[model samples]
Target: MTEALAVPRIASPEERITSIIALASSVDGVDIVVAAHEGFTYSVQALNPEYEIYADELAAASAVYLESSWQKLTGNARVILADQGGKALLVADVGEGFTVAILGERQAVESLLDPVRRLATGAPISCPNCSAVLDVHTYTCPSCGKRIPFTATLCPYCGTASPARSCPNCGAELMLAPGRVEPAKAEKQRSAVAVTPRAQSNEGEVVSEEKGETPLLIRLTIGGGVVAAYYASSLLLGIDPVIATIVGAAPLAASLGLILTEKRRQ
Candidate 1:
């Protein structure tokens, strides 16, 4: 047994990065974890199955760009938080050209700051809200009975206004107020009103055409009668009556044919 010596295997850079991401994914509510170095994506892990579709987006090199841009803007920012509707993004620069990103619910991502920093940098960072308890209480919509965030003033699922201004968990008074209208519904109503003028103008044009048709017909009939009377007077002046009758009826026949064709096409 002493003839052979054991050799320890060393993990590659990609493997090391993957292991870091795997550790980060152990936190509750964390959906995706991504690691990148020097503008190159090393690994992407989706912890939540429902969030697998967005994994490709997190693996892009743009994350590195975003980290650099944030550092430039803040002049020494190590961590960044961005809110994306129902979800949020947390990017931390763990030094040594290594950057880690986390995507999850807003409250979940906020709670992950200290743990993520400690795992990635071997040192913990201070966060003012890290010690505070996260708001995990959800409100039930009166209309749809769907559970929504405690801070939500309007139910996104049913567009109903929240009736309670107190915490559902501890029955404490909250500073939230009822929202007048849902933003999405208001935008849709504005768009519908914006197109109403165009639709009304189109209908007006149709009505004007319909009303003017009778006047046009009356004018054409009167012109044809006048032409017939003029030709009938020519017969008294010694012109052939049959020729005069044909000449007077020719204009009226052509007008009728044109009107019929237009109506058929319409």
Candidate 2:
């Protein structure tokens, strides 16, 4: 028994071709591709080329006819392949150039219609600096030497943004696209922690800090009392004055130690 493959249904031609182009682009060696209308006028509505196309290709007619026949009869798409030196094959949609047949390589794009549509419709975001589509948020513009912000209001280098809102460099007002300007958030109230009271306690703390005289005076008094006791004890004992001096100095030392400790506690 063999498993049957699911038939791809395309109700919308534009969406279907878009899916095909996206799939083809994923193929290795695919440079660019496009899908357009199935007519001779050749006004391309969609294309996935390496760069912006200035004019239509002369070889597009043959490719267009081949793919259009497949699409109409077999419900399948066709590809027009081109080689740019050693790079990927540039695949274009056969009929209208509204979709891409494939872009990477023949092997990679064998079953690729679904991918083309996804990619074409969901295009990658482009850089405001060099117009290169970026994968990640970056500060340095990959194409130009510009300092960009993580969340920039304007480009730091050229001072420009998409939709031409304002010149980042010169701060000039720019002509913006319709419905592009986002409304800014209104200012919110500050947190209570941010506000500090100016008034302070008056309990011997010198509401304002100044030179500490109380500590100095206490230290001076202690020194003076110790000196006086030593001299008096030396004169009175006369025999081994050092012992007498130590005895006399004990009380004064104790008082001074208590006073210093008390001041520190307060």
Candidate 3:
């Protein structure tokens, strides 16, 4: 009979971070660990039990870290790194920052990069507002104000009431408009329309988008007004019979353009 070999099991990133923290506490320096993904709040922690912080405070720290590294991280990715002579570890990321790294004696957490990277690649984030899958850095809704989390609800700056938590456009809080189920559904439909390809034979309803008044109409109206004014002035000056005809023609041309433009758009 062949002797069975014992297989070594790898520790998960969370486990590794915990282990590193324990060791760092017993030695010199502080350790920090962070983990963030879609639908998950950013977090920060100090390894030493003596270093206590409130949940809100930790969230603030994590948010700061995420904002600072926003430029460097990938979407739905995770990362883990250490500072303070391996005494601190920061696993920072939102969607793409789902990394778990340890900082300690270099020998204690060697070769952690590969595992952390793998974990990040395997785990993606879901949007908190709509539960749609999203990348780590996607703070704005891809469907709405193109802004997500920040603009759904009331305006953060103006303290205005909005329907959701983030804005659809600039990610500003939605205040002027109500975000009910119907509006949200419409927005979602619009986004779908943008991405979906159509087949010539597959009939679908063509939704009309609201647009500003036609430029032609504006021009025509302005032209007509100008002509009327000129004709009145000409009458006051006793100009020739041709002046009246030209004025009448201008108004007629303007009206025609207005009607045609409106009909074509409709």
Best-fitting candidate, measured by TM-score?
1
Q: Quick one: best lDDT, which candidate?
A: 1
lDDT string for model 1 (52-170, tens) is: 66655665633554545554222132666776547888776655566677888765576555444343443321112221111223455678775554445666555777644443323
Question: Which rank order by TM-score, best down to worst?
Answer: 1, 2, 3
Give the per-residue lDDT of model 2 (tens digit) for 2-102. Answer: 44222333335564554444333333333444443542223332234543352244235435545444332233434334433343333434333454433
Off by over 4 Å in 1: 1-20, 61-77, 124-266
lDDT of 3 by residue, 1-266 (tens): 54422222223434333332333233223333433333243444555444344323443455454445533434354454544332433444424323333343332232233333433443322223443222212133333322222212332223444454332222323221321222355556776777645642233333222233455556677777777777787778898747675866676686777778777877
**Cα lDDT of model 3 overall?**
0.40
Among all windows of ten consecutive residues in candidate 1, which has the lowest summed lDDT? 125-134
Worst 10 residues of 2 by lDDT: 179-188
Tell me the spans in candidate 3 whose CA falls farther than 4 Å from its real position. Answer: 1-48, 52-59, 70-75, 78-86, 94-111, 123-266
CA RMSD of all predictions: 19.9, 17.1, 18.0
Supply candidate 3's per-residue lDDT for 47: 59
TM, every model: 0.35, 0.26, 0.25
